[model samples]
Target: MWEQIRANKRNSILLLALMATVLALLGWFIGRAFSPDPAAGLFGIVIALFVWMILAMVSFAGGDAIFLAASKATPVTKDVHPQLFNVVEEMAIAAQLPMPKIYIINDPAPNAFATGRNPQKASVAITAGLLGRLNRDELQGVIAHEMSHILHRDILFVTVAGVMLGAIVLISEIFLRGMFFSSMSRRYSSRSRSSGGGQAQAIMLVVAIIAAILAPIMATLLYFALSRKREYLADAGAARLTRYPEGLASALEKLSQNTTPLSVANKVTAPMYIVNPLQKKGMKLSDLTSTHPPISERVRVLRGMAGASFADYSEAFRKTTKHSTPIPSSALKDEAVQIRSAGSQKSADSKKQIRDIGDIMQKTAGFHFVNCSCGLKMKVPPNYKAHQVKCPRCGKISAV
Candidate 1:
């Protein structure tokens, strides 16, 4: 996981550097297009660049915090919502980590997110509607999935991307608003800058101007794709950590079927949630360039993991969730991942390892409901069975 974080950091730096270069080149071209002399144009280029860098950094940092606040999420304690609190606690212990702080947004939108630079500092937030709507198991499923992200170190990308990507898009819009005027300004100011490579510089200037025009658009697209892919990665990681894939599956199903999108879910932080908070009910993830995998695909891959070996499930999930080429059986079968050296094997206990829903239902006596394909858990209830009789999640007719 540390290695993955390091690698992700490298990818982020490379992307940022790439963006900076394009912006610098645009400044250079803008100056050359207007300058009377090479030296003066270069000076203009440097000043323009200095301004862009300072603003970009501020915008990136400020945007992330502002977006989080805008989502109307407030940090909560065990007293706020004990059920969700306990669920996160159990998952934290299972993952062998400190408990994450919890937040609840007062919205009917069914979505949740984990954020912070690292696990030690992370916080998980869910919508009020999700709590009111889902039953015990389904809610655990969602918390488990979010905990998976906290365990896997995926929050860095989730948070940083929320900020920088937003800033870039905003920058693009600001740029576009000025582009036409700027282009005309360039034309009127085009008298001086002809130098040794006059024609060459002219063509380069045109290319740079066009690139400046498209850079934000490209950056927006890149951010969306990368953001969305990370969600799939987190999904697969969550599935790996919790072998009870059905939990997350049900959560996603419930979330997807709902239409109440969060009003606070703007472009910046929308991608961090378990499901896209954009309110689109029927659209698949592939149909849009948003930050989440389609709810349908997420649920599908988790359910498919039901009885498969961990190796088999991981490969299948990567293929299906991320739409990547199938991994070879030989590669996935590497015992290094699942099995360890002599006397040091990590037990396959990484899984929730529980298959009997009845056992779980029996343990949690609060408001229990159970359903069976064989129509057993759901039978005619006694007269007093009406109160705590049936399983609400499955809509099963209850007798127990």
Candidate 2:
């Protein structure tokens, strides 16, 4: 695990540096297009560095809040959802990490994710649909998977990478838009066309255009690469933490069968989810660009595990996928084994689970619940101002 963390750190640094270089080059070309002075390129580099720093600081400080808000997730208390809270607590303790703040997204997509700068500041957010669909062990599997992301520092790495990637895209967009709309750009082009070094300037312009177009794509590819690998590792960590590989395997199967697209998830936040929330249909070339490995493959690897150790997962991964380097050597452990095949457990009652989840979500969202004589529970929102409310199920009036 330490080796993997070190490797991720090194890779993150390299990736960020690569993004910075792209930004600097883009800035240099834009500056040179307007001014012939060599110092303009240096100025561009400085500007790029400043932008990167500012954005990085902002993302580090408040990205988690922004994500939660974007997803319409509300902070959840243990009292409102003791089962979810207990599962999170158990996973946190098993991973030997600080408890992450919990959130519940109101969406009905069966998905979950973890985010924050580090374990101390980490948070886990799951959709209401996930809570409704998954059984206790399945939920444990999902939570454990997210907790592994926190423990392994994948959240921090991904957050920093996302910030840098956003900066690159933002700068590139600014440059492209400026060139298209600014009169100064036209003047620069006219002047450069008339200069003695017109051919060189033309070449630089072409290079800049290509770089602007490709930088974001390249960054996204890198981000996806890192995301895919970290997911495999997180899965292994989850299996080790829960001592039940089948739990996660079964959860993956259930998630893959879910077809609902998450209303709040977008491209920027989709990769953070345990399962891709975008709900792509049919095999296409675009699947190659996905941030997650194929769900079926992940499930196969997990179900192939003969025990709950990292070594067992590693071996299973190799046999299942012919990938020999998914797990680091130092992280592998050989211990007592208890293996259960996928589908070994009985399915929970889905209607009951959905009702329980709805109640928990309503309570956490600050809705007042009143059970009427008609056996129907009425949920009044926090914004309701009336002192007395009439039951929708029964004509009985209830006092707030």
Best candidate according to TM-score: 2
Q: What is the lDDT of candidate 2?
A: 0.81
What lDDT would candidate 1 get against the real structure? 0.60
- lDDT of candidates 1 onward, in order: 0.60, 0.81
**Could you tell me the lDDT of residue 256 within candidate 2?**
86
TM-score, candidate 2, is 0.88
Candidate 2: tens digits of C-alpha lDDT, residues 131-198: 87787788889999999888888888877888887887888898878767865667767755555755
Model 1 weakest lDDT span, ten residues long: 339-348
* Native-structure RMSD, model 1: 11.2
Clashing pairs in 2: none
Candidate 1, pairs of clashing residues: 369-391
